[model samples]
Target: MSALTVSQEEVKRLKGIGFLNNKGTDDFSARIVTVNGKVSASQHRLMADAAEKFGNGMLAYTTRLSVEVQGIPYEKVEEFQKFIAQEGLTTGGTGAKVRPIVSCKGTTCQYGLLDSYALSEKIFHRFYEGYRDVELPHKFKIAVGGCPNNCVKPNLNDVGIIGQRIPVVDAEKCKGCKKCAMEAACPNGFAKVVDGKIHIDTENCRHCGRCVGKCPFHTTDESIYGYKIYIGGRWGKKVSRGRALDIIFTSEDETLDMIEKILLFYKENGKKGERFAETIERIRFENVERQLLPSC
Candidate 1:
């Protein structure tokens, strides 16, 4: 039994496969992919076993909705991978490829507008697994937030999908009280009591639909429930918040299509060793906007 020797190039390659080299040691840390931060009871048990056996007796959760088992010896990496495989878990959410999709607990949360877990799962399978081999200048991050509350901070990712609800008020059903419930419900103050009626300021309304269930008379109708997309946002040494696009995808299928298109556009136009944010800056947001939304 001799000590295993790992070169720098091997370390880089291993990192691309989700094995991060531990500082000042030949040991590695394994990042286990978990879609939208979900893990079953049995899977959790296996992970705990791996952590105790292969690495340190602890697991670390990443911001991108994955788990890392630290302090794995370089030689036991393959064995650990096999141990997790019986429970249907895999690694490799690193490198320049699309990273694991992160999402807030939208389905179970009271403030949720859409199923963030489901959406994130779809994106993970469609993009993360699908684009595992695709090389890019920088890692692409995607996040899904359930509502305007932005619990997951979608605006901080390379691609952000925010669930939105556009309230449609029926003026005929108005029993406009002096202090309308809609007015009180609106976080942005978009709903106003004007001339004894509740008037929603279209310009100012973020379409969060907080007023929908709050209207005492039930005048507010959720006419639209969809996703608001943002692009080119990242947090790093040079942080830039993503710009929200005017486009609102009405369906999950439409949202997935748009995501594919954005990735394709980035793959083609993004410069070598430059992030999507940098690409947006170099080519100008207006130009990228035109390419992303030609109809607009």
Candidate 2:
């Protein structure tokens, strides 16, 4: 076959479209898209075939819940993209836009408090797919954690959504046992026995509802389950943990609306080449919070 040649500008464009130049001459790696780390068995087989055909028969999983096939020649990129498109797969998670949405397997996990896969898929479609071409100050990332376990490390992403279960104590049914259920169930030590009664420190509570059903008297109520949002977080060379907002969205629609508003606000107020975390720091989180949640 003939040798493949590409320009520096073309390589940059290719990287934006999910192709990365490998160490080998003219070889590239293709980053395939996946939704919340979910892929069907058939899709896996297709990936295997693609890897064997165009790549070095190797596949790697990205921390962002995507797949990459390495060692494909530059000449085959167009053909490889077309082959993956037949299976409803595409590329382009890199750029100054929203990256792929990631989530843990909340639906099947014992400690999961919400359907993270479903919620992440919704986010993937609405934001990742919707804002595929929209320019941003820097790359944006989003993560959904099932509960306070934070398996997906929501606090390390640009936008973090964590499922929360608020525990409500029913004093009427309290047995007032020596060893309160909250003491054992609460992971953050927010629950304690105070003067022969169970006291839950609201400020320290993570709202994970670990105390629910732990009481012999069944005093912990698990009726309140919602989502907590954190903004201005990023994990990189300069790491900054996101700050959690006081707002708890009661419905998925509300959470989705809030995220959309956040994106719009960031687009309007953020300076070029600045990350959301930097923007929050520059303008002060309080001022940004006021703009995002004026009712607060």
Candidate 3:
């Protein structure tokens, strides 16, 4: 192998700008920010051009839905950034700030209860871009899952948002039919038929919406769509499953405000070099919850 030439100081600076040193080489990988895991077709072409002209003609996808162009010589880093900038694309998803968000395909997924792309895109602009320059205690990650299927593993991120469709059970409308569609629809076995009506064990329900519209007499015909937020979740070496907030938010604006509040709280209270999860653990979730949820 060859000896390293890039100084540690330069590497650290470049890393802040989303460039990672290619071990033993002065070359770097340019991590392109795709906002909410999405890019326009023209931007796609621009990235391809950047790879061929400046990088190693290869692009790799990140777990956070970022794109990395490998083997771009150090000298071309600035030029690479400028080239992508023409299409409104930029390189950088690093540092102890808000990282790029990961979104599930809830927009078009059949089982999706909400428009995940829209939600993630909204968050990208509100927090990711809005707080891009605001440094935080540590890297904060956000993931938007379409439903409880959790394809994007929202619960494993610093903060996660999953869609929910809680069934509205009309007990009086239930006919207590011998052959119950509710029983067949419920995957959790919480929906059961009793004397003259249907009952759902709401406490144990995941609110997956599977039981919705599954009754003969329209007992479970409607559902209330909402979002379930999980906080203090972390992944990687030492993983921690995030805990869900006590209430489900039905308004998008309300949810966005809550997210902003969480970040603001962490910014003011979290110790430097500590992850959000660590801060939550050290401060105790109850204390943090009180601050995040002032109304309830």
Candidate 4:
């Protein structure tokens, strides 16, 4: 990749303001960039104001549902952070080991089972410690979702959390209406209408909750079963989607703990600059899974 061209005129202008590099400031201190997302209009505006105060007013958005404000100099970083804190935001994920985790809200959908906001906040707060400075062999991405709508694309991240549901049919109330069957609610074609009666093929059903959504009488239930963990997915350079590690129980806090374990394991055992996928390919999936989930 080509080196960034530092505008001499811009540098001179900044230096003239006495804010470029103060006494004792590291000459090579990296520039600070701020970011937020499409949230409450108020927060979005607050982030924009922060960019005006701390950066060069250049903003960039990512597909992962975030915005980046760039061109911040070194000396004013502390002041910039203080200013952002007033807006109730922070910038730990912009630099390294773990980036800001992306997730979708459960409030907007009936299919959603877990609280995504709580999950996002918990992951963000807990994972920030030690991750900012820790170097990764390659950039890692994490995405979580509340259901099988694939909102976060579970199969396409270094780590992913996907929601699942197992539906229970009340045959007495079902009336064999076949409403669920007609909607094609089951991706596996598990539901069928025969003899004017709705029959569910349990063996083929993935229990994705669509049938429940379509049926008025059949009740829907969040599967006690946890999320399906995926490993080794990435997009850039060596693009590859992660494969399923295993089905884990849905404990948000515990899941984060497991993620930390995986990250640490990768750091200790992976070759320098090897991504999670590359590492998995080298060490073998079973060994990686054993390290990630020893009990199962």
Winning candidate number (lDDT): 3
- In angstroms, the error of model 4 at 291 is 3.2
Candidate number with the higher lDDT (2 or 4): 2
Across 117-175, the per-residue lDDT of candidate 4 in tens digits comes to 66666765565444766788766677777776777776687887776665665555556
Per residue, candidate 1 scores C-alpha lDDT tens digits across 138-179 of: 889999999888888898899999998888888877887987
Off-target runs (Cα >4 Å) in candidate 3 are: none
Q: Compose the digit string of candidate 2's lDDT tens values, residues 74-94.
A: 889999999888788887789
When sorted by TM-score, best at the front, the candidate numbers are 3, 2, 1, 4
The better-scoring model by lDDT among 1 and 2 is 2
Cα TM-score per model:
0.95, 0.96, 0.97, 0.72
Question: Which residue pairs show collisions in model 3?
Answer: none
| Model 2: how far residue 95 lies from native, Å | 0.5
Q: All models: lDDT?
A: 0.88, 0.89, 0.91, 0.63
Judge candidate 4 at residue 165 and give its lDDT. Answer: 62
